[model samples]
Target: MDDVIIPVAFFLILAGAVVAVAYFQSLRNRERDRQWADAMEQYRVVVERARTEQEATKLQLVEMSHQVKALEKLLLSVD
Candidate 1:
């Protein structure tokens, strides 16, 4: 009876330890995933802002080109 009891107790303790380790590992993985998601969101916001700025610059360049063309026409008429 004593021998059987010792082996049973040992096995129970081992199983409990494995469960504890698994639970803690899952919590760590969840935290890591959350951090990665936050980083990705920040990157997305920065990219979007850059795209908007580029579009504004392109528009400004187009307007400047039109103004230059008008000036050239005026100079030609005067000559």
Candidate 2:
């Protein structure tokens, strides 16, 4: 009886340790996942802002070109 009881107790203890380790690992993985999601969201916002700025710059370039053309025509007329 003593031999059987000792092995059973040891097995229970080992199982409990395994369960504790697994639980902590799961918590760590969840935190890492949340951090990754936040980083991705920030990257998306930055990309969107950059695209908006590029479009605005393009519009400004178009307006400047029109102004240059008008000035060139006026100068030619004066000559």
Candidate 3:
């Protein structure tokens, strides 16, 4: 009976230690996930801003092209 009791106690202690380690590891993983989410959000904002700037640049180029075409037509008329 004594031998059986000692082994049972040891097993219970080991199980408790394993559970504690797993709990701490789970907390660390949660923190890492939160940080990754924040970084992804920031990246998304930057991409949106770049897309807006690119659209504005394209519009400006189109307007400039139209002005150059009008000038060419006027020069031909003068000639």
Candidate 4:
């Protein structure tokens, strides 16, 4: 009886330790997931801003090309 009781107590203690470790590990995983989500959101925002800026720059370049063409025609007419 004594031998059986001692082994049972030891098993219970070991199970408790395992549960504690698992709980802490889960918490760490959740925090890591949260940080990853935050980083992804930040990346999305930066990409969107870059796309918008690129479109604006394209529009400016097109307008400049049209103006330059008009100036060239004017110069040719003067000659």
- Candidates in order, TM-scores: namely 0.85, 0.86, 0.89, 0.91
Local distance difference test values of all predictions, in order: 0.99, 0.99, 0.99, 0.99
lDDT of 3: 0.99
The global Cα lDDT (0 to 1) of model 2 is 0.99
Cα shift from native, residue 77, model 2 (Å)? 2.2
As for lDDT, the candidate ahead, 1 or 4, is: 4
Model 2 lDDT tens row, 13-74: 99999999999999999999999999999999999999999999999999999999999999
lDDT of 3 by residue, 1-79 (tens): 9989999999999999999999999999999999999999999999999999999999999999999999999999999
User: For model 2, what is the alpha-carbon lDDT of residue 78?
Assistant: 100
1 against 2, candidate with superior lDDT: 2
Per-residue C-alpha lDDT of model 4 across residues 1-79, encoded as one tens digit per residue: 9889999999999999999999999999999999999999999999999999999999999999999999999999999
Q: All predictions: root-mean-square deviation over Cα?
A: 1.4, 1.3, 1.2, 1.0
Rank the models by TM-score, top first: 4, 3, 2, 1
Highest TM-score against the true fold, candidate: 4
Q: In model 2, where do residues sit more than 4 Å from their true spots? A: none
Model 4 pairs in collision: none
| Superposed model 3: Cα runs more than 4 Å off | none
Cα TM-score of candidate 1: 0.85
Number of clashes in every candidate structure?
Answer: 0, 0, 0, 0
